[model samples]
Target chain A: MSEGEIIIRAEGLTKVYRRTSGGKGFLGLFRRRTEEVRGLTDAGFEIRRGEVVGLLGPNGAGKSTTVKLLTGILTADGGACGVMGRTPWLERRKIAADIGAVFGQRMQLWWDVPVLDSFRLLRDIYSVPEARWKARLDELTDALELGGILQVPMRQLSLGQRMRAELCGSLLHEPSILFLDEPTIGLDAVSKLRLRDFLRAENRERGTTILLTTHDMADMLALCPRVLVLGRGRLLYDGGLDALLRRYDTEHTLRCVFDGGAEPEGLPPSVGVRREGEAWTLTFAPAEIPVGEVLAKLLAAGPVRELTLKEQDTDRLVARMYADLKLT
Target chain B: MNIRAYRTAFAVHARQVSRYRGAALGGMVTQAFFGVMLVALYEALAGEGDLLRETATYVWLQQIFFRAFFSTGGEIYEQIMSGSVCYSLLRPVDLHLWCVCREMAAKIVGVTMRLLPMILIQFVLPESWRMLPPDSPVAFVRFALSLLTGFLVIAQVNMITAAVTMRTLDNKGFSGLINLVMMILAGNIVPLTLAPERLQAVLRWQPFAQMLDAPIRMWLHAGPAGEWALSFGVQLAWLAGLTVFSRCLWGRGIRRIELQGG
Candidate 1:
């Protein structure tokens, strides 16, 4: 394989967990029960070098399981997965050397130690050379705004500060691929935007391949150009975020204000209009009726003081997709 | 294996322990109090002889090594329960060795911070209450080696317990059972030599005896040359056996690891 090639390839990857149940009392012990949970079923995707892809799913939808499979933390029951041109489960140590992972709910830093000390420890753990380690530390500290909090114990830092420290520590080794699970889960608006900006810069400047899983729509809109949506342990959508929006986002709303408290409209059969006082709102599928023609028809109906057109929001579009897939 | 990675793992635990020096000092006071109580009890029972002195010394040694041998497994249990063990799996190092290094570092820090003060207190006590020291440099070196082996044996047992915790995801019952069993069989509460011959015969071959009883006996030069050699051999053998057993358990346990906590 050449440099900057496909770094992660997974095909028909599957995992099933056998969980014990109903084994409580004496009779329950004799009649032990077991149920199979499908963690990932035929989940497949490919991520190239320097690509920032988002994995989106509801709870228990196998988002975290897929990341764990790819990272070699959990072995797959079937199918194939290759990370950095090697099988992740079989060559986990080798792959771990080339990737950095941050599970937002779990911390990798020493709790009582200073953030800088944790970074230094990670530097040694990854065996990053002195010169490169120093340069990377300086750059990350500046970019992540971690200089002021470097000497603070990790347990003493706020959630945002601790997360920033975590991101800095994960990057000190200069891994080619970075996996972030819910990186912006509990951050304030400003901190979330700052983290998104830093991630974008890291992707642009360092060409780091990032796989992000988050529930935050803003994070998806701001960071990932390509998204993989999983529903019920299956990959439902894998393409550009814009394409997902365009395909599922068909409805558009048109709000109009009539002149002199008068509403007169001979709207098309495809359009549904709601009237309240002098204002009228029309909802229609843009794919069936062109926006230009609709505006012309609305103008011809009556004298319009003002008009506004709004597309469907992305979150609603995603929710609709989930409902359509029966994954909600 | 990455030597530097393991070293850093060790250093991190050591630094964490150092940060909790106040807690360690408090632990020292508690351990010293227990040591004095045990020494007086043994003195009353044994009535002031070499055996009484030896029992007192054993009590002191148990206090010194309590955290090192007994509590290392608790750390693993806590990590497993809390789901932070996922970080260990994510690293590019051998998880077993990394855990061993971390426990070793904690043991070093615990010994340094807690053991010296307890020993100094014992030294300052009345001669009748004082415990005997190692008789010669050779004997002391042998005692140190035996204690080091004892640590390895305890670490192996801890590794097995940790692997079991990884599989079960609940460790309170299992860890408590293991501690209670070790306390009895390893002579932590009372010397195993005082037990019946048949019980001693069985316990001598078990791994728990190798962890504490053998090492303490060797430290006091209480046994003959042949017995000392046998004790060292038995500790080494148990270490080897437990290491293999724990490795297998770890392999199977990791395959089923759920990482339960968020």
Candidate 2:
């Protein structure tokens, strides 16, 4: 509603999916069973206007479910969520004019139609004024580099080109907020970087609030300063990305080639050791035991030939977080 | 809401439907083959007379507009299965009305693309198998209006099929069931006139008959002013009933829809 206002808020939002398991035998056929699977549970967060926030979660952790609920695509089974100060599912059509969404696994464009035709259809559907529509279309086409593929059918475009076109389509209406589910999934390095840059510019220039769900930690690092992490249908963390990473990123690895048969031992049990072809790898959380202390222990145990230290990769950090939370 | 948006959707869907000219050609050939076989079978059983003549026209009309009887909601199925239907749901328009308009466009355009070629088969067939002209100019007019009403009814039927597909997550069972019932009761399998006398009245008044059988009968025999009114009244009644029922089903289905993919 205003600058720096809360544009999106979820309070104890939850969803449980009813899954039916068909019966097997003749008598069992009449006794079909329906099981409720928790999709989201008591998930809550607040997103300010123009803020870019990433949703981090392992598979089936309700990241997409959260997006769907916020976008009015699915109704939450418990609690409430408000977008632009209105309940999304209750006022879905009213909110439709103010928000746009892109799902990476799905194509909103018509497969057999030319890209521009689909754009035109969306233009009319959103009721964008003709003059503003043309101007916005032109700008988006240029920005997303979809100018050359305007006349191509969606099925004929490469994945990278199609995703760019999808971004352009979602932005042409100048929605106040955008929801992207796995927007950069299956994208090449160059395309992913370009997509991140385009999204950043869009947020800056239009002050469009963005809520993106992605498995790519790099995308989260580059685009979202703040993130909400969900695990096992529950909110695990909600704060700055750096803070979340720092909490779990303490685990560090050191690999060193021994000069001879000097066995590396007598180190604290907190540190894990593994033997490779020519080097021994040691892993220890810097928070539990200081990196310097572990290094000294390793040096005393073996004559180091070559050594390198590496922080836990983001993918592993997330995996470890999930493991710690018992979400896997 | 600009009515123009709905009109544009109709236009776009019509364009999409018109793109399948090749399919229409293939369908015409198949329909003509079926038409010839049905007419020959009817002639051998019924002998040459007014009954055979009327049956020939009925058979030809069935073949001519066969495309309309099939569901034109293939895109809805694809969208639902692929989870792309979220885009359709996200649009500001009423989802039910939008789908109705789309299916209407597809049915009209899909049938028109094949109508002429299939009609031409009437002239090419032998004398006994040839389709007859409408009973009179007034009958033709009634037939035209009734046929348009039939499209509305079938469009609602298509939407119902889509709703069922959403509920079941499988279109084949309901789609096939609907097709079979429509073929048997709507006179596509055999003209209701040729059916046993006791069953004829019941079959003629059923909802499925409103799709084409009732309209084609007007073309064969435009009985009287009162009969014309009754014929159209039945069609409109069925259309209204179906529209309401399908809307309810579709609204409920959409509220609980869980798209197939992530």
Question: Which DockQ value does candidate 2 get?
Answer: 0.41
TM-score of predicted structure 2: 0.90
User: Model 2: iRMSD?
Assistant: 2.6
lDDT of each: 0.82, 0.86
Best by lDDT: 2
Candidate 2: C-alpha lDDT: 0.86
Each candidate's fnat, listed in order, reads 0.46, 0.46
Q: Per-residue lDDT of A250-293 in model 1, one digit per residue for the tens?
A: 67989898776655456677788788777788888877888888
TM-score of model 1 (CA atoms): 0.91
User: Runs in model 2 with CA error above 4 Å?
Assistant: A1-3, A22-27, A252-309, B81-87, B196-198, B258-262
